[model samples]
Target: MVPHVLGSGPTAPPMSTPVDRARRGKEARKRLPRSEHARWLPSVDRADPVGVLERQGRDRLPELLPIRYGRMAASPFAFLRGAAAVLAADLATSPHSGLTVQLCGDAHLLNFGLYASPERTLLFDLNDFDETFPGPFEWDVKRLAASVAVAARENSHSENDVRRSALAATTAYRTQMRRLAGMGELAVWYERIDAERLLPFARTARGRRQVESTLARARRRTSLQALGKLTEVVDGRRRIIHDPPLLEPAGAADAASLRKIFSDYRSTLSEERRLLLDRYRFVDAARKVVGVGSVGTRCFIVLLTGRDANDPLFLQIKEARKSVLEEHLPSGPYVHPGRRVVVGQRLMQAAGDIFLGWMTGPQGRAYYWRQLRDMKGSAEVAAMGPRQLRRYAELCGTALARAHARSGDRIAVAAYLGGADTFDRAVTDFALAYADQTATDHAALCAAVAAGVLRAAPDV
Candidate 1:
């Protein structure tokens, strides 16, 4: 089935002026009432969550499948983090404003983090885009809001805290969108959330310390630091260590073909980036397991050195599969899955990785490559207090708004959201309700593992 691209072909704008566009957007709310968002009950024949996961596992490494299940089985929040496909199926049937944008697809709270820009400054934005695709703007927002409630529950916060944090997120999104809509097109495109702009959001002394500490830690995670920790001198040559199941040496054939893959990947970059990358020479590669959702997928870390032995670079080549949203939404015009991820990320991120590139593997599988660790850090959501969580939620909303404004019609979205609490309240209600569903689904996952229907390797 061919997926139709959102906002495709030449179509007249709803209005000429920004104010008129916003007004038209507000008018759209009549057909798709904000209250429609309050409906969160799954349909009688909704797709089974476990079945979707098991089907996805077919395309991944057999040995690491148990680890993926174990991670999700840890908590409801963990399950939500890895189950973008499950939520995509369910959200496809939900009410939308008919407005579309490049979605984060899995815009949970943990996905927002601090990463370095080319200037070495810490910029806060959405860090994961494995499931990124063109979809209704609300889907990303809903997923983010629902995650707040789920995380709140996991942290043992009161019901009021959950509702408050969720509401704060939507409110911040709406407010920021309205502000961005008032700016010029180029101005909106250039807007970003860096550390300097993020200081006001830290509400307490502890929060301030957390921010400073996270930034300090991110700046220190350079390739040199990774080289020292992940590799060792063996017989006078630096080699990656083998820690079975987590980090194992690639097969002889896979290692031999990596040089060609690296060459093909370099060709995808711009002339300047390619020139910059030419200084480094590929050394060795190892099969490595990564994030919870990406555990079973084929991930390899390639070690490279430049000029001398002290100068090192680490590039992570991760398998890119069809987006979870593809079945439910229009797929972009990209033949290779790696291109889809690369293009989608360029469209969404304020500043992207310099080494970002894509190539097809020996088996014709698509993969994208980027620096393995470049000042990236995520907040400790599990350890956050209620106040910190609410503040973090606000920051996430702001970051998401900036991303959508760059890809979608900001004026129209602002109009659709308007200067009211109706949509905010409805989203809060939906998040709370969905958090309940997540708990129930998590229990079912535990049951599946206990009944021997699924295997799980916990604490890995």
Candidate 2:
């Protein structure tokens, strides 16, 4: 089925005035008070967290299931990273503000990171879009806030500090949304967080040094760097090096399948990108493991060359399944899951990879393709102190608000938030309560593994 482009159908209503939009937002408060966001008790019949995970894994590679479980079992923070489905179910049990946007679906703290924009400038924004879908704006906010709380607690921060970090994230989000709400549509559309702009927010010589180091490291993470690290001269020709289970050569059949789908994927790109892609010659591919939640999916990295071997381009093909949100919210526009991801990323991200595209692969599996690494880097959340974590949380919150403003009704959301810290405090309470729930769920997973109900391989 052809997906309907938003704001284009004949039935679409005329654009509402800012006053009307603000009034609508206030009306929603009558249905669901901003303070109600703090509520987070699991229902009596809430689904088993492990069972929810198992169901998600049924269609994934069986051999890789153990890695997924093992990674999640490592800690409560790790469990939260891999348990988007669990959180989706829990969030569905609570009422929302109905302020919809293209959610990152799994907007954990780690998911916000640094990447190169199309103009080659470094920027910070929501980088992961594997589970992108339309849903209540607060779902993404809550997930991000909860992730901050979990990470802060894992770092042994005081409970007061943990809540403070979570509150920092929510407050940044609210204030940024309100700021964007006042701007013209074009201004909001052009908004972006340049990596250079983040340095001043570090607040100390040490923190500023760390930020500089991260930006430098991200700058060095191009495909050429990946080529040196992930490939080697074999028989006088470069080929991907094998690292069993994590990075292994794709079998002959799998290699051929990727090549066959290459043209189909290219067709999805714009004419200029298609011409740009034609400059590269396919070299080699490998079956790769990625992210905590994405571990078991079919993933591959294809090496290509432009002018010569020295000019390398690496593209990743990752399987795209129905979003975890799909089961809880109303159906979205796109029938093809891969298209859903690509479109969502374009809609929400200020600048996106030029290589982003999608296609159906072998056995009707849907997959999206993009540059494997283009000066990409993520913050080292594990090493952050309380002050640093709170600052980082604020940055992530600001980025999330910019993203939400692009796709959702910013005026309404901003009006609902107002100048009060009620929504911020409410969400912080939810984050702490949900962090406790995540700990309980993590324990359940470990118990299942111990009982042989689930197998967990050692962390790779």
Candidate 3:
């Protein structure tokens, strides 16, 4: 069971002192000194990056594993995003603070973005949770820090800029977490990083305009828009048009099987949600390839039409596997892997997709369902200059801290971080060092593909 460092009750002790929570956090420094974070010591028995990649592809479709490998070959940042298992192994061998939170096990820069809440407001938060599980809170921060460094390096930023961006992230996390640590529980729970709050962080007119343009584009990405673009009238009925490899028709037998699974999925929803869901009639399902790491997994797009031919609802049912951190950290007390993803997502985000639920498919494969695309906007880290990247880094750090604060003892963590740059510099040092390791790993993956150990379909 996950233990709460802060005791619970109507008259809980004040967080400032509260039986020296801060003192304990400060004491943790002695056990795992901040300076030690600068090191990335891999043991002799560490898993080979290529071997791990091959093992992950075992259960995935053979045809699509090439695409997964190809995406990772694109760049070191892409490889880092896809190789969560590889990094998790390394991080598990590193020093930790023994503080645990629901982690976004793959908390790369691209994964922190804007998505619409149930109320239709776009909120910025961690958008990926496929690898989320209980582990050292530092793991998430480390991933984010390393991602920022790698991305800055990929964009050809100066070494100083890269260090600044990395430090900005950890410093923002430290500053924001300390702020949240002093707030009332409800206040912290209600806080969110919406579009309006993010504008001030834009350092230039171009950055501000980019934010506006991205928001406008996200707001336009509704179900109706997707329906118009992805469907066509065939046999006097609406059907999802095929875009081979990426989007294609599910086989007749598979579609029938999924229809039954929809009923089981409905049972997992609340009564109100079930009534709302019943308004739509299932029409068709399609296989959809998504994300760099998730390419080979079984992901499907289910179409449902409501009210009239113009009204549409698209639900993505993505396969869930054991978290990347499962081997590194203690396993969570969840029977269904899909449920684990759903619950971890809910805990880490201030709000989530309203249709979120999970079901077990044939052979007991776990899958979770949510809206296909609801005003989702991801930062083009490729285009970001040093200034824009630094601001983005700070925002992502603050966002991650808020997410961790929700699930872990904010007081203890904040106190541990304190008001110093020691931990910030240490994480930055580690991020840069790991960025080098990622480059080496990416080169190895490219070499593996070239040597025919793995096939790569870069265009796909």
Candidate 4:
């Protein structure tokens, strides 16, 4: 279980030494280097598994930006394609972890989405921590800020419009940080951003209706229900159908190995979890696909039946290489990167998927397993207007601050945020500036793809 957060606030200039006192963070937002090189941006830089990713990233920028998610044949999210390969690596090299909580190292715009908490409450936070680790609070905030600029540009919004939206995001982050700083440790931990609680902030009756519609969709993201839809008897044999770009399967050998590892995978879970699933017997399994950056990586789904065909469960095993954040972090080389990542997710998220666990194969690779399609969904970014985006960004910002507070020192972060707009303004400035860089990076990746330097399997 996650321990309660301890808060701290310090306002001092950096010491010239590497002593423990050197660990005390500066109060003012130091003019962070324009690029990620000067002081590391975050700590994920040191992870090696991310390096394997680095080689591929050197040329795949076009496919990872927001512009691409909206235009699949053209590219992936432009910012993601550009940023993850190198910027995340650069951010990771920085020494900011001691400043606040271990952050979701790559907390960009889309990472925040709905998930059912342990109490069945739908809330949001740094949903993807593939690169999560101890790092500066600002790095997460800045990455988020830059993403807004990129997303706005992709929408064909004017520069002024993009700037306004980006700043709104930054300011929200700063304000929310202050709110969290003022809360008691327990109060902070218990906080959540539920849909019903968000009605007041929805700018319009239409927005409220849209939010309600989203909630209705989110409520349907349960494990049993999702598997029931995805897994069915085909030709008197149980199997999952091809869901196009979304739910494709892996190779036959990989599927076989996944089946063999299910029991061993159960050994890694707690007693209660094992007992909760004792009746489940593996029925059919196959390689499945998911996520933007995680595309092309090994992902699989396992079908299990309890009493009969009507009673079913599905488990997904996703290969967990080190996050882009790991490229700069100082963690000892992880023997099982997937296990390390899943354990980190469990530690950070208030509630995790019930099937959330780890598994290893004979080849000594790690995978993070969760119930496939278990009430899993996201807001359609293409559908929201500017005001909704702003409001949603604030929610994401607040939730991110809350997530940080839980894993690290909230008092110190609050103290660092103080009662001003310094942090917010700083993030806004950094975000707009970085967006320019990401756009450039995206162009570079596109060139590489055109030149065949990077493989472009851009499936819409």
Candidate 5:
């Protein structure tokens, strides 16, 4: 089956024939204006956003159920927490005629953090791509702004202060993208952040403390330690522990299909990676759960042990389906969305997990796999302050632009962004405005839950 590319033009493969290809090439060569629908994605009503998210996310829930929340525990605004898809779709409908590339879909302030790179460098990046897909440039920026706005309101910041922080974030993103776009690809790839570099930027004691904690935790998060926690010899049988709401042993047919998928994963590797696979035996594999938004999707963890059973490697295979962003994405040229994600990730991030690979299941269900816990960790967003929120936004925006530049024309975007501060200011305006929308939406969710209109286990 052919997977259609959305906004990605020539960056994707041809449309089968020369005449068809020529027609697409001609349209693509022209500055592709942002579709009218992309722009309004950010302007959705707060009440409507929850409905949209629930709808786009409906297909996955039967696979894994939501851990119910206590009505009083979730901050009123928390309900609107991950409304990035609604915002992204609206943003895609908006305006622009510049370079387009794959986006993180939901580049919120809370999603950036420290993790170990292949070479063991502590790196920062846009970590969550659940909402990832191709769309207008501003969609990510606006979602980021709204996150801060909603978070700040929860934290009791004044409206003006929240707006200012959001603007600062917009400024940082625009400035960083322009700066990085000026560098050579290899140089950008070499760039990374560690605890030492953060000292200069972490202004507050809280920020400093948080960074120190994350770095310390990251250092302790080794493959050896994860092996013990995620796996064990159960009752004389060496098996992955079956934890409800987390690990699943799989039905007979599912396990059979999984074995084939696991076997296929080996061939997807390179000579170097294939050699690495020889170092460990696939001891136990099972379907495991992960992440808030990704809960209902199928996720599996494969455990490996080598030599004296001391050496270990873990791989995570996650089902990749049509992104909710695809609701707004009309098919174009690319047939495989998972391939698009892997390719885009390689382009945008400075470095990626060496084990990254894609596969299609017997049912044509697509998925991508990587190391399960190679120094994998994330920041506790609930602990951040307003200042930290702003700075994080800058990181996400900078990273988003860099990722977008990987497959799209950086020069054209830089030109469209103009040789000035126009783009930054425009983003700031959008952020502040959208932040208001997010707050209003959060309130509606709270009221709905109170009135028993929309069901959530009371926001626990």
Candidate 6:
């Protein structure tokens, strides 16, 4: 049974004058100079990256491990996307700003994207929270900066352009944080980046057109659209289509387990949401593969009908394990892993899915439920040129700062960053260094596959 533990609510920062907050920030700078962040050298005893991945995969579905390795082995950037635990360990070795916030623990570029708000408006913000936990805000910043560096290098940007892209991310983060520090509490809480606001960041006509296309695609990615693509009529009954390892029909036992847990998940939702969910009757389910890091986890997509066969809703039930950052940082509030993810996501996102909820399934595994497709769209980083990459990096940085401002001490963080680009440059340097480490790590993974130390299914 899942433990009945009461989670703590968000606490406001202690009452203090702006002068005191600024002083606190300055003091932190003295303790750990902003320039000190520029350093990054792997320890001689650093754990093998492949071994770390093997440890993470032990608790996952064994058959799916090959697919996880295959997806991560595709590129250095892809490896970084799947190796959040490796990055967490590396970040833990260095001293941090000590500014606590609910981190998007795996805040890579692909994790930030377009999703529909409760009001059906498209908003860009952090969309993944599998690793979300309260930790030094700099951890997420470094991850974002490092992702930009890795992606720029993958696109064959010049060394200077790569560094410039990383710098743009940190620079925008520092500047936006400072701006948020000067805002009223409610104003900072309400701040968001609407999809329309993204147009101004596009420097050229082509860039603008690309942004428009992405937005249009996101708007079309509702549950209704997924019905046509993922479902078919079998003897007048709607059923999920099979697509082999990526998407396949759930077995009789697995389907029964899913149906049994449906009520338990419904209990976690608010009264209104529960009523909304009750309107949809269960139809079918399928085992599915998802993202790079999450591929091996037990994930299932359930089909439900609302008013009629034409009206459908798809909810995804994904396993939630202990966060990668959990061991590196102090203990968090929630005991149930699924609740931790749901709560962390709610705290960090400007708006979240109404169907978000959690439940403990068979054998005490934790799972969270949410819409499978709700106007979600991600960026195509590989296609971006240097100019477009830098702009996108800046946009991501701004969104990161906004998320941090909601959960961390913006005044102190802004003050520590100061009115200069020192911190920005330091993190940028760290990003380049980490990008090199990631390349070496990716090679190690490939070598492991070649030596028969690990199995890697061909990329799907």
Candidate 4 wrongly placed segments (more than 4 Å): 1-54, 57-82, 92-100, 243-252, 332-335
Q: Which pairs of residues have clashing backbones in candidate 6?
A: none
Clashes of each: 0, 0, 0, 41, 25, 0
TM-score of 3: 0.96
lDDT of 2 by residue, 1-460 (tens): 1111222101111298999989977887887799999999988999999999999999999999999999999999999999999999898877787767789999999999999998999999999999999888898999999999999999999999999999999999999999998999899999999999889878999999999999999999999999999999988999999998999999999999999999999999999999999999999999999999998999999999999999999999999999998877777889899999999999889999999999999999999999999999999999999999999999999999999998888898899998999999999999999999999999999999999999998677
Q: How would you encode candidate 4's per-residue C-alpha lDDT over 135-164 as one tens digit per residue? A: 557777777777776777777777787777
- Each model's lDDT comes to 0.86, 0.92, 0.88, 0.62, 0.62, 0.92
lDDT of 5 at 385: 69
User: 98-209 in candidate 3: lDDT tens per residue?
Assistant: 7667788999899988889989899999999998887777889999999999999999999999999999999999999999988988998898988777788776797788
- lDDT, candidate 5, at 303: 74
TM per candidate comes to 0.96, 0.97, 0.96, 0.82, 0.82, 0.97
RMSD of each: 2.1, 3.0, 3.0, 6.7, 5.8, 3.5
Off by over 4 Å in 1: 1-5, 8-15
Give the Cα error of residue 218 in candidate 1, in Å.
Answer: 0.6
For model 6, residues 206-266, the per-residue Cα lDDT tens digits are 8889999999999999889999999888888888998989999999999999999999999
Cα-based lDDT at residue 332, candidate 5: 32
Give per-residue lDDT, candidate 2, residue 142: 97
